[model samples]
Structures are given as C-alpha cells and as structure tokens.
Target: MSESPISHLKFSTILSKLRAGINASDLHGSLTGYLCAGGKATEDTWGEALALDFTAEGIQDNPAFPQFFRQTRAQLDDVEFGFVPMLPADAAALETRAEALVDWCRGFLGGVGLAGAGKRGNELSADAREIVKDFATIASSNLDVSGKEEDETALVEVIEFVRVGVLLLHSELAPASSPRPATSPTSRSLH
Candidate 1:
C-alpha cells in the first residue's frame, strides 16, 4: 500500500487537526470500531458515537473531519486499512508513546462496545475475541521496546499485528458494497 497519508502526521498533530482531544489511536479506533460493528450509515450517528467518548467536542462538522471520515472509510472499504493504529514515531519520551498507544486501544475497545459488534448474537468470533483480549492486555501492560533498534522492530511488528487483526474483523463484520439493481422505469401511456 502507498505510504499512508496519515503517516506524516504526528499523533498530536492529527488530534489537533481533527479538533479532538482524544488520543489519535482511540479516535481512529472509534471510527473503525463503529464501522466494523455494523453502525448505521448516517454521519450523525457516527458523530454521536464518537461523542460518547468526548461529549463536548463531538467530532466537528468541519471539512477536515469529513475528509478524515471519508478517507478512513475508503481505506477500510478498499483492499485493507493496513492498520497503523495512530502511534507516533517521533515521541521522544517512551512513556508518552506508550500512553498514547494504551489510550488508543482503550478507545478502540470502547468504540466496539458502542457499535455493538457482538450485540447481535451476543458473541464475538474466536479470532475477534482473542484480538480484543490482546488489545486489552496491550492497553494495560507496560510497553518496553528495549533498545532503539529493538523498539523500532517491536513497534513495526505490533502495527502489523494490529492491522491484520482489525482488517480480518472488519471483513467478517462489514460486508462489501454491491451495486444497486436498476429500478424499473415508470410506465407512461398515451391515449
């Protein structure tokens, strides 16, 4: 996949641009979670769901946000999202970086709950359940990547893992769009 448009953005910058105080990961997770959970098509419902986490801000109606929503949907709907999960590459402080990741996972799980992913059958697939459990573990556990090289390696691996799991779940939950059948033309009669 092409280098993600969002790759250049530091997690902080993304949050600012989106006018959302929530961590970038969580915001992304919420959006993805809602879509995967079979949330409705109305943009308002998506906005409201995001608001469940940030009541006051409520996902601004500004151009950037719409663009973000559009882009996110496109990514998910296309070949696959590649699941970057909104972590910052340049965060100088390890703790801060870890905190952002944890917040993101928390937000993602919250989004899943809000979207009611498993509410239908009251069950999540085994794979999905494992993924959720992993996310929960990641959210609560300490992140120590060891040395610089190892940290980079670990981060890359985790990103890949998260991307794959999310994509699989998305595919399972959100059916691809199909063309609408042509409607029959109205009959006209002349005397």
Candidate 2:
C-alpha cells in the first residue's frame, strides 16, 4: 500500500511544536470520527479538534495543507460502504509503533465523543458496541514489542483492527441524509 500524505508528517513533532495536547493521529482521527458522524469540519471545527481552545495556525499558508486536509475529508466521506481512510503510522521501533497505534485509537474514540456519540450511544448495534469497547481497550495498551516476531505480527493485526473498526463505526453512525438536524453539533476542524 502507498503511504498517505500524512505518512511523513511526524505527528509527535507537530504536537510538540504547537504545544498541542493532542497528537496528529488523534486529531485527525477525531476529525474523521466527527465527519463520519455527519458533522461538518470547518476552520472553526478544526480548533475544537486541537482541544486547548487555540486556533490552528500556518495551515492556510502551507501549500500542501489543502491536499492533506481534503484527502482526509474525502476518504471519510466514502461509505462505498467499503473504503477506509489511509492514515499514517510508520514508526521505526516496535515500541514507538505501539505508542502511535494507541494514540490513533484514543484519538478515534475522542473524535466520536466530540461528534455526539454519547447522545446516540444507545443506538449502536451489538457489533458496533463491541468494536467501540475494543477501541477503548486498545487505547490504553502497554506492550513490550522488543523486536519479538510474534509481537511485531500482533502489532500489525491490532493496527488493522483499528483501521477496519473506524470504518465500521463511521458506517454505523453516519446519518441518512445530507441535511443536518436542527440540534446537531457544529463543525470541528483539523489539519
């Protein structure tokens, strides 16, 4: 599989520079989750995803920013009833990879909540509920990958589970129409 544009943008470094509490994966995941729940992600919405109540700066000036943001939005919009977003996770060390995976899952769940998952949490199907619960568990994973072959394999599988799980949650929660309900939450933006 080819890498995402996000593949090279070190999320940890970005968060550090911005002094952001949320990492890139979680921020993007939140945006993806919010959109899947049928919430619009505008510039203001982006601020909410940042979570510290601070505005995301420099994006409008960065030439690559538009494509990156648009690609994420476009993929999440795909419910071909099949497509999954091509997110980034390419750490060199097993331990780092594990951390990134946990960050991704944690972000995804946070995104879901920001999009009003609780309001309709009870509406989730049996399969969906199981998936959501699984993500919560993965978010707190404490693994010692130490270059063990089995551990490496398990990491791959867990990451795959998250990829598919996000799509499942999006599919299950997405509304049926283009029109937003009168009380639906507004947008939450991301990079």
Candidate 3:
C-alpha cells in the first residue's frame, strides 16, 4: 500500500528525453545489481560501471538521474526490506509488465557482471548462488502469459523472489564499510 519509491512513469519519461536507449526497469535493475556487487553509490561510479556515457550532450547533469541513483541506494540499504524493481504499474497489461521484469533481470545480471561479481562466485552462499541462477533463468526465459489470475500470481511471486534475492546478494557481497573509488566511464559497449 505504500507508494513506490521511484515513479516508473516519471523515470521513463526522463530516459525517453535523454534517449538513454534503456527502459526504467532495466536501468534501476542495473543500479541495484551494481550496488549489490559492491560498486560505489555515486552517479559517476554507476555511469562508469555501466559504461554509460553521461558526458554525451544532454545526458550529463541530469537532475533526475542523481535522485534515482540515491533513492535506489537507500532502498537497497533500508532495514525494512523496501527494495522493489522499477516496473510498470499493476494497471498495465500483464505481458508488458512481465517483459519489463525480464529486462530488469537482464540489466541486473549485466550490472553484477560489470562489477566483477563473477570473480567472487566462490564466496557466495548456496542460497545466493541459487538466487543468481534463478535470476539468470528468469532473464533468459520467454515468459508466455494467458492473462489468467494464476499467471499474475506467479509473476508476483517471481518478482518477490527477485527482490529478496537481491537483498541477499547485497548483504553478502558488499563490503562492511569501505569507500570505493569511482572509475572513469569508458566507451565500451554494454552488450
């Protein structure tokens, strides 16, 4: 019943204006993934980790992105388990929302990979490994929906699983209290 920490519509509009070539859900997922993998929670570091060229014309100094970045970091660090992926509202079509979830998972996987989480695979607990595996499957699966109530319920369950899984990853991977340096953004391809 609480309002979403970030408004998907407003965030999506900001991305559209910036021509960021990514949806809001995916971007938020990437941010979450990066943070979970111990990346610094700064606009520059996030952009660098994701290889996003914020210096490109209108992308730099965008007021919305910094707010989004801070809000996501706070949600992940919140003790009350408030983290949620930025996806379409429940009023949206089931298929549309599902696709966004898929995109979000993909982005999350990419972010973790970029943050060198793969190198720490041996350190992850069994549950964390399973969570990563499940996220990978979700990211790759072609979810076919019939718009049935059961299908909606299943989607909700999967989303909740993702939310908890991310929290686990963050707790296990992020350093206890170390400051990370911000890397310079490069022109590498995100794919």
Q: Give the Cα error of residue 12 in candidate 1, in Å.
A: 3.4
Residue pairs clashing in model 3 are none
Off by over 4 Å in 1: 1-11, 17-19, 42-45, 52-61, 80-83, 90-96, 120-122, 176-191
RMSD of 3: 8.0
Quote each prediction's TM-score.
Answer: 0.71, 0.74, 0.87
Model 2 misplacement above 4 A: 1-4, 8-15, 49-52, 56-67, 79-91, 175-191
Q: After TM-score superposition, what is the CA distance of residue 32 in candidate 1 from its true location, in Å?
A: 1.2
Q: Worst ten-residue run, lDDT, model 1?
A: 182-191
lDDT of 3 at 14: 83
RMSD of 1: 12.9
lDDT of 2 by residue, 49-140 (tens): 53544546754344343444565665655545333433345457778777766777777777778778768878987667777788788777
Residue 8, candidate 3: C-alpha displacement in angstroms: 1.1
Q: Which candidate should be chosen as best, given TM-score against the real structure?
A: 3
Question: Model 3 segments beyond 4 Å from truth?
Answer: 1-5, 175-191
**What lDDT would each prediction earn against the true structure?**
0.60, 0.61, 0.80
Candidate 2: give the clashing pairs: 45-187, 45-188, 45-189, 46-188, 46-189
Compute the lDDT of residue 15 as modeled in candidate 1: 62
What is the TM-score of candidate 1?
Answer: 0.71
Q: What's the lDDT for candidate 2?
A: 0.61
